[model samples]
Target: MIKNGYRNDCFVASVLLTLYANFGELGGVEKLFRRIGDKDITAWNSMILAGARPGHGSSHSMQLLQELCQTTLLQIESATWVAVLKSCENESDLVAAFVDIEWKDDSSWSSIIGTYKQNDMELEALGLCNCKEMLNEGVNFTSYSLPLCFSACSQLSAICEGKQLHVLAIKSGYNRDVYVGSSIIDMYAKCGNIEESENVFSEQLEPNEVIFNAMICGYAHHGKAQQAIEVFSKLEKNCVAPNHVTFLALMSACSHAGYVEETLHLFTLMLDKYKIKPKSEYYSSLVDAYGRAGRLEEAYQIVQKDGSESAWRTLLGACRNHNNTEIGEKSAMKMIEMNPSDHAPYVLLSNIYNAEGKWEEAIKCREKMAKIHVKKDPGNSWLV
Candidate 1:
């Protein structure tokens, strides 16, 4: 849109810059802003915001913010201040450098709190929260920012801090807020407080698919497959259609519990009922589940049907475990045909032969690999 010479309207250009920045196309955003010729404070604010958004590296954003501070003669606005503060929060070194700078309002405080939270500096985030409370200075922190602080505490497994943040959130009437509630549930779950996670989920005014997925993943990851399945069932009862992540969680639960029959059922349902095609991870899990159960034929069939290198590799791993040379050779051959340059199959095949005390065969395989120039690269261990 900026390419068509529509840079006259600052508001339109600001919106465009925001969109580009959100999408990580910062270069395009800079091009448009520079073409405006007479850059306004709003344009500068937009550029700062574009740079400070999460997932955008803080170093580059900080550099641009410093340049703006040096070059611009205009008074710095609150928005620009917030963006720069946020960049500082994202990087701890910057936070220490900017700590003495006086922030005019709660937004700037929130930005600092969010940065500490995002960087997993739990104590720092909690300390700032306490400072806000001590000020009692009538600055109402935004509902959105507190959850990030709680998330930090959760990451650190600081349950006490997380609970304090939870109380603050409720007192501030943000308990029922979907985003806040989801973060709280996730925090509790991540901290291994499953009961607290459930309590938070139950209290939510409107739990979305994301919240449901979080709970499901939490249960699956913690080896509570039955609980994960129950949560998934409830999600379905609530009319929340499962997405790709939903299936992945379900597969994880099944794989963990070695519920081969259930895994097969869910895999079929994912394709036929939900119309969700299997991803590489899903296929790999299927192969792993079957292979672990000593069902080599079933594992091979899955790899053949999926045609994924990961799936084939899973079968090869199983063959190694069971000492099934016949199937192992077939799997290795198939893998080489699919990706001849990959050194994994050759190494795995050679290992399989060595395990069987077939040293001659192993040497022959190594000779064949050398002829094909398929040498193992340093630091590329097959185990990982």
Candidate 2:
């Protein structure tokens, strides 16, 4: 349609551009965007939206925003700002883009706070909960806002802050909202307040998969394998089918508590009963269970079959944990084969040799790292 001089029709071309972007076909959007000569606000917004799609990040959208500002006399609008804000991949960039908005609406404010929590900038997310500008603008908290606020509080272990949010959630009558309920459960569990988490879980009139998953994950984090599995059983009894995330949390709980048999059984059940394809995280947890049990051979077989670098790294870490020199050497070699430029395999292999008191082998591993020009990262730790 665009090829038959429709590109000259700015309205038609812009519609085509918006349609392409809506379908996540950035290539078509780019082609349509370039063909238009004198673009208006709608055309610019469509181009910006396309750039904001996944894989392109915010680079293209930000570039277009700057170009629109410098060259075009048209003022940037709210939709454009929101598109750029949504494109931001990290907390700092998200903050910068958000502050560029001429007017902060409820949706834009929600995006900013949600971005903070999504990026794991918990302290910042918590701080955003009290933004004076947003408060002055009468931007009220919604169901979406409560979850991230609770998540940040949970992560920072700000029990006082969490309590405040809990009060707000109840007073606003959103406490029973399934997503809010799940977030509350997650926050309490993460803050080492499992009792509070359980209370919230029990209060749910009808829990969804998310609520069940959160409770199971809470138990897993607390190393309460019995409780986690028991929750899974409850979910099954309630006829709430488990998803991939559910299985991941369940397997992790069993792995951490050394329930190797249960871990394997759950993995089998996930494939045969639920028909969930094994994601890398799932395979990694299963491999970790075997590795933690010092079953190096089984771990190796699983990682190789799974074909994930992170899973292989887990197996390698397990080798170091159990001091299995032979399997550690094999894992190290395979990791190097997979990613020659990565420093992890070299560092892990060298540590394994050092742990076993094989000084020569350790020195050789370091030499190989040096030869490959993959500098080992400096040792660092935080006082948590």
Candidate 3:
């Protein structure tokens, strides 16, 4: 195609770039991407995604995005901002990219705020919404941006901020929006106000799947298994189809309430009836349910079948609680094999040993952690 003078064709080059990225051919992707004469947003997005891949160095992707930003003729779409955000390694990088945009659109604000929330920087995410510069720039909150701000408030348990954002949503006429409503429910529930969450949920006359999932998740977090189940019944009565999040929340609720049988049944329903394939979280939840019911062997068996690091860690945690040194050691070993740098398995294994009065083994576990330089992260309080 290149020999036939199709090299500079935007569509063809963009397709080639995506193919190279998928194949992990970063060198060829870069070479061919630079050769495209009339580079469109598609080409830029392709290069950005390619460069952001695991080993390709997000710095290169950020550089490419910066170059694209400098090209005044090309319009940077939300997709481009999303691609660049994926390349941002830290909060500073995200803020820098956010502030660099000359013309901030609703999508741009949503993208950066959502990224901050995803990175667990909820305070920073909320800061963007209340930032003096953004306020001075006359940035208005739309449905898209409002949902993310609500989610940030949820993460931080910032009830005051959440209520203010709720008012903003209502004032902007986005209170009726399904996504925004869901976020509001989630925010209220997470801030220890399930009653308000229920109120918000009840007000949504035409509750969709997302809204129902949020309500169910609220119940799950509050250990209201019966309430979650009742909501699920209503969801079915209303003929609203439930998705993975719905079942995950149900499983979590059942697990927390020690309703092991209910949790198992929901797992089967999700798999056989809903045909939803279980991911690591699903498996971890199942292991947690079984472990909480004092079914350590069953939990271990589930972990063996899944063989994911998360499942193993869950099982290890269960073993620690049950004081099952044997299975705890196995789970810890499996987790270590999967991710040697993780200090969680080491810490859990040591706890398991100490719980069983095996002080020597616990000491050995700590020594191994030190030898490997696997430093455990210090705990911090979100309230502060």
Candidate 4:
């Protein structure tokens, strides 16, 4: 009693399966598949896409696909196979195995290349890039695939390859695309070409918030705190209201410069002026700023205000720096109470006792740690 008078029942079943899959009702889709008796190629594709979509599915979606490929001996469409391969890139062994599998078309090759890039398998990604040239099959690289390859070049710090990709992006008319533009900026930043990053940012036809955030982070990460702050000022003047990420970049800059007053001012602005509630990361940065400046009391006060374990740990670290046994003991107790398995506070407390010449107390602390199997992290000096 189907109303549409659709002659092909399999087509109707496939449409319903796709609907269920898209809505994440996989069990319902499976039930429909079972009722349909003989599932067609479209039905199988619908099921495959269901598992490949971002959330509410297993990472083993690709394995399921491989199983399907073997059982049916069916020629999987390029789009379906590409989705499965993209999922496998996260597994290095799988990527290596699948590289030998026959692809449907050039798009499939681009997909595999992009997958390798996304997974940080730069060598594999580069190999695919070289393979495309060797074949000389006139493969048309899509906008989606080019950014990913550019990302791999960025990670490898291959300035030459990155520049070539930028030129390709311009030629493909994707230079103004937000995703492509962001990748270009990130590549320049990673290659230590801040001027190039800035130039790209300036030429962006419609720079999105992500592009601005990347620029800000690049300056902050390279110790150009002043430049980071200047970017924020420009963002404000341009009337692009700052988001959470914008504040994070600003806070990072403040933290690196040890500008306590400015840090406090920005922190307040985030909460009051901007009306953005401070996230745990924001609080942690504030604690780090106060701690590094040897303002243990200020660090302690921030933790007291926001009762987060991460904030407490930051305060405890500051206590260790100042060797404030009293505050250290309190912070350690609080941290342990928050999460007993945390080893940091115990080690910090023991160090505090050792600094105060309380060897017996330190030894007792060590023994307690031994009973709980807590181990201290190896100490390494940070130059900056």
Q: What ranges in model 2 sit over 4 Å off?
A: 1-112, 115-124, 131-139, 381-384
Query: 1-384, model 1: which lDDT tens digit per residue?
Result: 556667967888888899998888989988888887677778888887887777665665666656665676555555665566565544454554345343335665676676556555677777666735535756664665767776777778878878877887888788787778778887888888988888888786667788888788778768788888888888888888888888788887887788888788888988998899789989988887788888999888888888888888989988988888999999999999999999988888899999999999999999999998988987766794
| lDDT winner, 2 or 3 | 3
TM-score of 4: 0.73
Return the clash pairs for model 4, or none: none
Per-residue accuracy of model 4 over 1-384 as CA lDDT, tens digit each:
135544247788878877887787888876776676565677776666666666543455555566665666555554555556544435554455455454334565665676666556787786567534624655656667777777888778888888877877787788888878888888888899999999998997666677788898878768787888888888777777789998888897888688787788889988898899998888888988988898888788888888898888888888887888988999999998988777888888899898889999889888887888877777798888
Q: What overall lDDT, based on C-alpha atoms, would model 3 receive against the true structure?
A: 0.86
Of models 2 and 3, which has the larger TM-score? 2
Candidate 1 colliding pairs, count: 0
Backbone clash pairs for candidate 3 read none
**Best model per lDDT:** 3
Whole-model Cα lDDT per candidate? 0.78, 0.85, 0.86, 0.75
> What TM-score, computed on C-alpha atoms, does each candidate reach?
0.69, 0.74, 0.69, 0.73
Q: Per-prediction count of colliding residue pairs? A: 0, 0, 0, 0
> How well is each residue in 1-384 modelled by candidate 2, as lDDT tens digits?
656777867788878987888888888888878889888888888788778888878878777877776677776555666677667786567566556645555665666677666656789889878744566877767888888888888879998888888987887788999999999999999999999999999999999899999999999999999999999999999999999889999999999888999999999999999999998998899999999999989888998899888898999999989988998888888889999999988888888889889999999999989987998778788977
Candidate 4 residue runs with Cα over 4 Å from true position: 1-42, 45-114, 117-123, 129-135, 377-384
> Per-residue CA lDDT of candidate 3, range 203-242, in tens?
8979999999999999998989999999999999999888
How well does candidate 2 match the true structure in TM-score terms? Answer: 0.74
Better of 2 and 4 by lDDT: 2
